[model samples]
Target chain A: MTALAPAASPARTPLGSSIARTLRLGVLRAGYEIRVYFRQADAIFFTFLFPVLLFGIFSVAFSGQGNIGTAPDGSGGISQGAYYLPGMAAAGILLSGVQNLGVDIANERSDGTLKRLAGTPLPVVSYFLGKMGQVLVTGILQLALLIVIARVAFGVELPTDPAKWLTFAWVFLLGIGTSAVLGIAISRLPRRGKSATAVIIPIVLVLQFISGVYLSFTMLPVWLQDVANVFPLAWLAKGMRSVFLPESFASAEAGGAWQLGTVAVVLLLWLVVGIVVSRFTFRWIRKDS
Target chain B: MNNIALPDAVVSVRDLAKRYGAFEALRGVSFDIHRGETFALLGPNGAGKSTTIEILEGYRDRSSGAASVLGTDPQSGGLEWKSRLGIVLQSTGEQGDVTVRDQLAHFASLYPNPRGVDETIAAVGLADKARTRIRALSGGQRRRVDVALGIIGRPELLFLDEPTTGFDPEARQQFWSLVHQLKAEGTTILLTTHYLDEAAQLSDRAAVIAGGELVAIGAIDEIGGAEARVPLVRWTEGGTRHTERTRTPAGTVASLSARLGAEPTDLEIYRPSLEDIYLDLVRENAEAAAAEIDADGPTSPTTRPSATDPITEGASA
Candidate 1:
């Protein structure tokens, strides 16, 4: 038998010193997750790069000189290219944080990665927080890439006011919180690692089309508009539009307004509901059901 | 450090049972693993060995009774208590894309004090594969990675569930040595495997569990009983073979030789192997179950036996 060198004995410390330990361990776990996420070409392409590509496609297709919608000033027409910027940005956030996050969580649970971590001394909350931290980092990068594509390719104006940026920040945070929490909550439905994509992608695609990620919300039928309004995705798109679009586009919205209060309330409610449901529904490992 | 006296038991389980609705996975199983000892829980598939270990590891909840690991109840074991325990699961519980070194380093940070990541990689014989993605490694290499993660925490108690299932023979040898090194350093280990020879080779004591109950448990040689430890004598007489288990095998063989007026033809003496005892014990448990069903009516709800008796017979060749 080949013998390897023995490990040096670790110095003893009091047990359960988790306040400091949690932060240190959470950082390490987050770093590990980020490294692995970047290394997987498939994860990068589908979660981040796919959104950038979509941004380019949507911006170029809508860049025609023709004016198609009511301008923010209630003028006869608005630039179609400008109309798509926030829409694609909303889709990007939903794909990376909600849809992709669900698939990742499902894969991890079925693959026993979550189970292994559950057996360790690390806190369970730390595991989720660390993973969410990685998702937030990636989500920011994905959003940045989309914004860059919009400004460069479509001549979309950047938000000039600091208040608009503040609005953008809160909307982004609440949108990500709601979607990522829902992502974790929804992962309980997929029993197998391979089926996560099968279950999540189609739903994301349908939601994207219906909620105006692929087209203007006004183009959808009235019933579809009502259905879209009930879900957080539609409100996310509306919220993002409020941050990027001028004030007159509010008339195109369902209530003829951005409904910023409703956006915050609805997203916050979803976030809270997602957390509660996930606490009850999440399984560390597969069950026979 | 060489001769520090350790606790009487690092793991103490008593009357532990787990029930999933009406189906009972563990039926009041009990065992103890003293500090610095390699203990094996030997059983067949679905024998509740995994259930028992998992309960002790705090990965699953138990229905009744008590389990203590590192002097704390595993059910509510705090992080400090958890840090002292290492669990090597049967499945590959790692990201497929992470490099070996990175994975080990990440797990190392979870514990308060941990073995160096590079050293752990070498200890598990994964130095060559340290930079390889887990998905790119072979089955045996992944198993090594599992062990590396299990031991990186410098746990006082380690739980390994079928740790060598996919290992090649050489890798298995290396793993055995790694376990031995851990034992020499006074790490208490509780292992479960279907391999009887592994139990005999590595464990100071072993418990044979079958049908969610412990059929027998003791020192490897003396598990079945004193008679099982004794040798059996066999001889051929007039084209027929006769065999008898006896504590006084020497006297029995001498008397048989004298009666035959020479060495008996095809004379042989052998002690019952651990496998022999284990298989006999399992068979006895099954027969006992069948007998209980017979004694009780088919419609009887209490056909499951409340207690199992270990059979003393060791006729296995």
Candidate 2:
């Protein structure tokens, strides 16, 4: 008998190889994205830590003097501290979803890194999934930080109800999905990305404010408040406040505080829109402007 | 054409065309690169080299014609085919904040049959600097990293676009040896470079491209073949300098010995090197460009056709 040459046990067909390739690429990309966040100390410091700090300052500066559940019996609505928690959490987490994902992706595309991977076996989904994965991690961290500050430092009421925790998770995930897709859509618009942070920062701040991140949605012009409801931030804040505050205190403008069905529909729509726009308009690798 | 029984033509580009609006970058350019051969694509700047490479790399779509790489059309072959080919671009690939070893290892996993990361690092002469972050490496070291990544997959067909742009003399020789190793492994290589000396040293066959068209292609020895071209001998005899051209330099030296009744002083044979042929080709390419311009000669301010006139790439390739 002739001796046989040992070979690489020929790859398990095209389908199996493709699946393995996709998984490996995705994991590596996800790891790199988290590493990028760690390396950019300032981005982590600014995007996450500062927003929680800002919440703490405002929550402490205005202590007590207001009630929860029924809009303080019209006694100045509620304590500034209690009132700001939901908004602050929404704002902080939204920054992770939008500002970081949108601008950095645009910058990467322009820098030719995105194009460099085009020839590699790395699936396109893996890279974007990596971004979303990073955002999710940061979002979870931001959520924990916000809760810790609200409880330990500000001494604000923590929602003890099982339902409230469920609400928070759903709302938080929705907010992340909506904000991420919005960022991706924004990234697709071929604007001059050289001064990316400069443009994205102000826009992020403005959107947060418009969505009642800083001021109450009720205080805003009714037209603006109505428009804000169309976004994930408004729904997230509404859902968060519903859990923190009792149903009676829920604002009518928030469409009866937490309409779970409405929140679900809006989130789903945002998810669909995000996917469609990212698929077509999101120039993940190219830009003329 | 010669009926060359190719071992599965690795790169078969048939009338590949790319038209960017009014600017036609490539017009029906055609070439075939056989497997297990170092085929050099020689061209001047803006000679459609990049556009051609980009199309072949599956990064850009050709406007027309077919281009197949590794038996699959690059435009259509999705992920599986890409993993089999290695491409070293003229530009450096992206670097993240990681050691060179880690980066190579990570990329190695992306391919089915990747070489060991440590071995690849040694192959690229980066064993000493394996732990260094890419940002810390010099321009030459960084270029080496690009080459390492290109070969980590043990690709069957490797495209090296100016792979030795920043190599020192010693490093260039080292790189030549490494490329020889790759070639020995039966990796069909397609390299584009302006360096004629590098091409002559490495390539078995060469194809010179100009004006978006292949000007010449043949074996490196037979290319612009030089053999029939007379050798020029220069020397000083009897304290007087003299130079003469002859078909047979040996015969010239013999005649000189007989005439002087002694050995000619400072006698040196000067067969035209590949450098001479390359420069002459570049000059001729330039002259052709000038002549084309003179003929077309912009009779109007713009090349935009009037309502009655239409512009075309003059018949076709």
Top of the candidates by DockQ = 1
Interface C-alpha RMSD after superposing true interface residues, each candidate, one decimal = 9.5, 9.6
Residue pairs with colliding backbones in model 2 are none
lDDT by residue for model 2 over B1-317, one digit each (tens)? 12322457888888888765565567777888887899988877767777788788876678888887877778776777878888787764454567799778877876777877887888888899888888788888888888888888777788898888888888888888888877777778998887888899899998777666677778887776654346888989668888888887898889888998887788899877766766667678768866776788865222322212111112121
lDDT of 1 by residue, B1-317 (tens): 11121358788888888765555667878777898889999877777787788778876777887777777877777777878888898865456788898788888878777888888898888888889989899888898898888999988899999999889888888888889899887888999877788888889999988888998989877798876667889989999999998988889988998888987999999888898889988889888867777888575443333343211011000
TM-score for chain B in model 2: 0.84
- The per-model DockQ list reads 0.43, 0.29
lDDT by residue (tens digit), candidate 1, A69-108: 6557766655666777788778878887778778998888
Q: Taking the tens digit of each residue's C-alpha lDDT, what string does model 2 give over A1-289?
A: 0111222443422424555556667777777777767767666877868779888777766655455433435653455677788888888777887787777776766555666566667677666677777888888888798888788876776878898888888888877877777777777543445677777888778778888777777778889987887777777776677767655566554555467778778877988888788767653344111
Worst 10 residues of 2 chain B by lDDT: B308-317
Off by over 4 Å in 2: A1-24, A56-79, A191-195, A245-248, A281-284, A287-289, B1-7, B93-95, B227-230, B235-245, B256-267, B299-317
